[model samples]
Target: MTIKKKSRVTSLAAGRPPTARKPKSISRKATKALINTHHVLEKKKAQAIAKGDRAAEIAIESEIDALGGIEKYQLASLQGQRLDRGGDSSHILMEWLNSMDSTISSSAGAHLKMLEVGALSTKNACSASGFFDVERIDLNSQSDGILQQDFMKRPLPKDDSERFDIISLSLVLNFVPDAMGRGAMLLRTLDFLKQPDTQYSSGLRTFFPSLFMVLPAPCVTNSRYMNESHLETIMNALGYVKAQSKITHKLVYHLWVRKSGVQCPPATFKKTELRPGHSRNNFAVVLSGSSG
Candidate 1:
């Protein structure tokens, strides 16, 4: 019996599993390769999104969310810099205009008058934009022709003082939070714009005078007011032709021109309340970190 028991114990000892080996750690090179693969996938996905691929967009966005959406992905990218979407439209506008025309020349450039709403400085206004005169205005800022009242709270520019050939609405539209308010704000802005003065040239091919406007990207996509199609339709109805458009992650810049003879489409937001304070108030309360 003892011999039999000894044999059983020996068999059990022999059957016992060899010491388990430790799992291998990922090598630094392998880890880098994995990360590179991920970035490659994301780049492909981003390219597809640029081409308006919805599926790719969703996939990438999901990954962005998994990796902490707001932190991992920037809203806009330009020349290796990240920009706050809707922070400024002037740079985008400058790039777009530069693509078509050279910077402002002193003699003829004087004929081009520009208006910059929420304008902080004239730095990129006239010279960079190829404009003759640039009027910088902010809320309640009545010094040196800078209207000092809120765009919605204040009265319209007294007489022809508020008119301009080009109006930069950079980052302004996004201020208004409500959908209808945004639409109303847009309509009201139109009132300040004048048809480009074609009186200079009589030829049919002469530069058709038009209003040039630069606004935020969300003006088309975000809000309850409408979608891109509706915005285009509305602008078209107003007799404004979309002459040019540029979209960056941070901002959207577009040129709108009203032909001399075209009648504006019947105004939809004519009676819509210009919630002048709504946008400002919302930002003031929500984005308190924003400086004066």
Candidate 2:
């Protein structure tokens, strides 16, 4: 006789399903902690927006403070002191002022020609009206008629035989994708500004002897390739020397002089230092043609 073993019955077999594990409940303290963390993150984001919104105001206030408040201005006026006097940039301003004093000429009659690369609103605004016969050349195809025309297609006028006293390439180098490309573009700019005689002349010569390059300051571009040293190196390689340098709010203005007769000293590195009896922070560099 064959005997069949009885099957063991589970809770499911008995019409009661096995008890499922329940999720652990969060404590009130943990819930509050999570809420607090979320709030902190939101607060930080708000603070960042506030900071960004007030950045310009902060910068202006800082500048005024550096200038020694209202008393400094009073003293400056009393002493007949020009605020920007002895700043290496006086030469450029003097040249511009001298030009302005002369008879006003048509945009065509102006002796000095200017080629502004990467034409932006700031460059356009700072540009002297009737100051050096100005011609704007932008690379963006969309900027047609806004400037004279795009530089890539309509090359600078070959017939007009005037050389620019100053050629400005402002705040545009960092946008170049690579160093080789940037170098090529820089060379091209130099080539365009260069006088035709230099192209055929025997001696080592340049097209436009004066170049004002306003590069992105330490604060402007995030790219490693774009910096003060890099720009100086490029200019030096192209046979230009730093004639003047000033650290303004948004940019590093460098007035470069092509192998001119005047040999200026190299730029000196000066750490801003606070001293006793000094009205404000002072930079220690001795201004000369060459960098110290």
Q: Count clashing residue pairs per candidate.
A: 6, 10
Model 2 vs. true fold: TM: 0.42
lDDT of 1 by residue, 182-288 (tens): 55555565556654453433331122234445443544444334445555665665556777777655345666666533233344432222234333212111111
Question: Model-by-model lDDT, in order?
Answer: 0.48, 0.45
lDDT, residue 278, model 2: 26
Score every model by TM-score: 0.50, 0.42
Candidate 1, clashing residue pairs?
A: 140-148, 140-149, 141-148, 142-148, 152-276, 237-265
Q: Which portions of model 1 show Cα errors greater than 4 Å? A: 1-88, 99-110, 125-130, 140-147, 153-162, 200-219, 222-225, 260-292
Query: How high is the lDDT of residue 292 in model 1?
Result: 10
Give per-residue lDDT, candidate 1, residue 116: 67
